[model samples]
Target: MLMNILSIGSQGGWTVAIVGYSIVFLALVCLVIVFMNLPKLLQLNLRKKLVKEGKPCAEVEDLNIEGNVNAAIAMALHMHFNQLHDEESNIITIKKVTKNYSPWSSKIYGVMNQPR
Candidate 1:
């Protein structure tokens, strides 16, 4: 910043680019962190609401699923999704149709010869 060499301007192009990239990277990281914790935050909020409404603590047990149960649920979901789509043969067929050319259907002839 103190000196410019080899026709390099003191405007700090690299510095601006680096700072801009750093800001964007930091913002995206912050967004990812928020999204990663969003489900937990939502669950906590739901728990608060459920408690306020005097719902039975049994329903709260639903929110406290273990890792194994989570894995089972994920597997079940994966299986259900896999079953939802029908299998395709993945074969493509292109059929060409042939039609005889008729003089009555010729637009070029009709355009060249005008009606009297």
Candidate 2:
């Protein structure tokens, strides 16, 4: 029976894993659904507010920002973010280090003696 297989799976930690996975999956699914409809939900609220203020539905429903304006906004954001120019005083420093007796630099202990 299908119940036998269900019992076997339930006895292991598979049940907990499956339950947690399903919970997360369902939560993400719910989030996706809400996000997908979020714009519509906001628009509905805006429409209601507009109607309450005696504005017609047709104009309110088809409201859109112009493409050129949107592009300009996008370009401005891009320029603002991608401003890679940093003010710098062109200066460089070089130093040399020498240690005369470091154990790491000494070669005396590096050789292994052969066994006869």
Largest TM-score belongs to which candidate? Answer: 2
Global Cα RMSD, each model? 9.1, 5.7
| Model 2 RMSD in angstroms | 5.7
Among all windows of 10 consecutive residues in model 1, the one with the lowest summed lDDT is 1-10
TM per prediction = 0.43, 0.48
* Model 2 TM: 0.48
lDDT per residue as tens, model 1, 3-110: 545238556777887899999999999999999898788788888898899996468657777779889999999998998677788999999988899888888777
lDDT of 2 by residue, 1-116 (tens): 98776777447677788899999999999999998898788788889988999989788657767669989999999998777666567898788977788887676656573445
Model 1, which residues run further than 4 Å from truth?
A: 1-12, 36-40, 56-62, 65-72, 87-116
Once fitted onto the true fold, the runs of candidate 2 whose alpha carbons sit more than 4 angstroms away are 1-10, 41-85, 111-116
How does candidate 2 score on lDDT? Answer: 0.82
- Assess the local accuracy of residue 20 in candidate 1 as a C-alpha lDDT between 0 and 100: 100
Specify the highest-lDDT model's number. 1
Candidate 1 structure, TM-score to reference: 0.43
